[model samples]
Target: MNTKQKVKYKKNSKKKMNWITDHLFLFPTILFFLIFILYPILYNIMLSFKKMDVSNFMTGGVWAGLANYQAIFSDPLLYKALLNSFIFTFACIVIEFIIGFALALLFRQKFPGVNFMRGLILVVWMLPSVVVGVLYKWIMAGDSGVLNFVLTQVGLIEENILWVSSEQFALIAVTAANIWHGIPFYMIILLGGLSTLPRDLYEAAKIDGANGWKSFLKITLPLMKPTVLVLLMLGLINSFKVFDLIYVMTGGGPLDATTVIPYYAYKLSFLQFNFGEGGAVSGIMLILVIILAIVYLKLMQKEEAN
Candidate 1:
């Protein structure tokens, strides 16, 4: 070969090797995504179209087309689960956001042991959901629970309210537990957003005679829009997937009052041995999450563009 041709060949070989190496670095992540995420999702989609019960689980299921989906839609339980999931998520988001924002504001001020107090609050969020569920289960016990004791002492209730056992209060009990566990997370996110605000804007607002509330309404809300949007989107998705706490605490009981979508799916698959129906419920949740995720991405892109 000519010298220039040989040099070109060497350069091409070098580029090829570099390309292979760079692509090789991504192989593990790609493999993990395919095996753990994509494969299960595809398999579940397939399973949702089958007629699978405990009787035929070992032998595999017959092709049922859209039967599973049809059954799920026809059942009133599905609608009830959806309603409970929405109510639980909505309550958590509202209560957690309001309290989280307030705490974020308070912690923003310079104070004694501020960092320690912040860290202490985070301990609640850091606990595993199962642990939090267990803790609340004990606290909400009707007989000798601390909560009932306190309420009785304070005259808030004439008797134990049966927080987790009664159909009337079971959903509220779980929701309150979830809210407590989630508050620190929202507080941290809002705190970080608050930290990024320009101090000069508040000072500028002061010159215009803007009070604390007025300055917050004018300056803080507008600037924090993106952060708030992202936080709420994430909170919604996470709340929808809440099964561990419900399982550990209520087990979707009190006549299914706390049976949100995730736990409902679990009941169909594990308890009833109706795998096809369970997969259909899961598919519904997957669609909801995918829609939320798409919205989140679109909002992020818009924020970046602006």
Candidate 2:
């Protein structure tokens, strides 16, 4: 072949090889995703539509249609769990956002220990959530809790309070621990957003006779809207999916005050052997999250368009 023809042939061969390699590289990821994630999701959806439990495992499950869903709505325990889930989610969002924003704002100014403080905060976030739960359970022990000791020394209380044992306080105690552990994550993300903001905007605001609060409201908040929205959506999702902390700290005990939806689904599946009901719960949660995600994206799109 002529040199020009040879070069053209080589280019064509290279393009074809590149296409093949790209497709081939995706095979393992696609295979694992389907096998591990997608397959289980699809299987769970199927199970949700049927009746399967310890009683009918070997004999094949029955078809329940919407009965399981109706049962979910009708069951008082399920409603209680749903309420607790919302409470936990709301508390996490409020507490984490407040603490995180404070830390981000403080750390925006250069200081001697700022980096060290940031690193220490990240350590809390890096610890496995289960480990944090277990550690807090120990710290909140009725007799020897450090919190009780400190409070007593400060004359805040006369005796050790049963933080985890009381039905009235168990959920609040667990939520507090979760807030401590989760605030770091939010702070880091918000700090990144803060760092990216234009200092010139703040400077101009100050030049134009804007005070701190005025500048924050008029410039900082509007500029940070996208980041704030992203954090809120993610924080809500993460809080709803909380399981390990409650399972370890309270075990949904003290009249099930700490039982969130994830823990409830776990109990229905493993503890009660009600696989169908658990699957249904999981499916419902999945649908709800997906709907929220779609709604958030639509809002974001509209905001961006304007």
The number of clashing residue pairs in each candidate reads 0, 0
Candidate 2: Cα lDDT at 88: 92
Top lDDT model: 1
Q: For candidate 2, lDDT tens digit of each residue in 1-306?
A: 999999999999999999999989999999999999999999889888788998897876899998788878788988899899899999999999989998999989998998998899899999988999989888887898888889999999998899998888899889998998899989999999999999999999899999999988898788888999999999999999999999999999888989989998999889999888899899988998999899899979987998
* Residue 104 alpha-carbon offset, candidate 2, angstroms: 0.5
- State the local distance difference test value for candidate 2: 0.91
- In model 1, the Cα lDDT at residue 72 comes to 94
Q: Residues 1-306, candidate 1: write the lDDT tens digits.
A: 999999999999999999999989999999999999999999999999999998898888989999999999999999999999999999999999999999999999999999999999999999999999999999999898899999999999998889999999999999999999999999999999999999999999999899999989999998999999989998998888999999998999889999999999999999999999999999999999999899889988998899
What's the distance in Å from true for residue 65, model 2? Answer: 2.0
Candidate 2 segments exceeding 4 Å error: 1-11, 58-60
Model 1, C-alpha of 297: deviation from truth (Å) = 3.4
At residue 5, give the lDDT of candidate 2.
Answer: 100
Candidate 1 residue runs with Cα over 4 Å from true position: 301-306
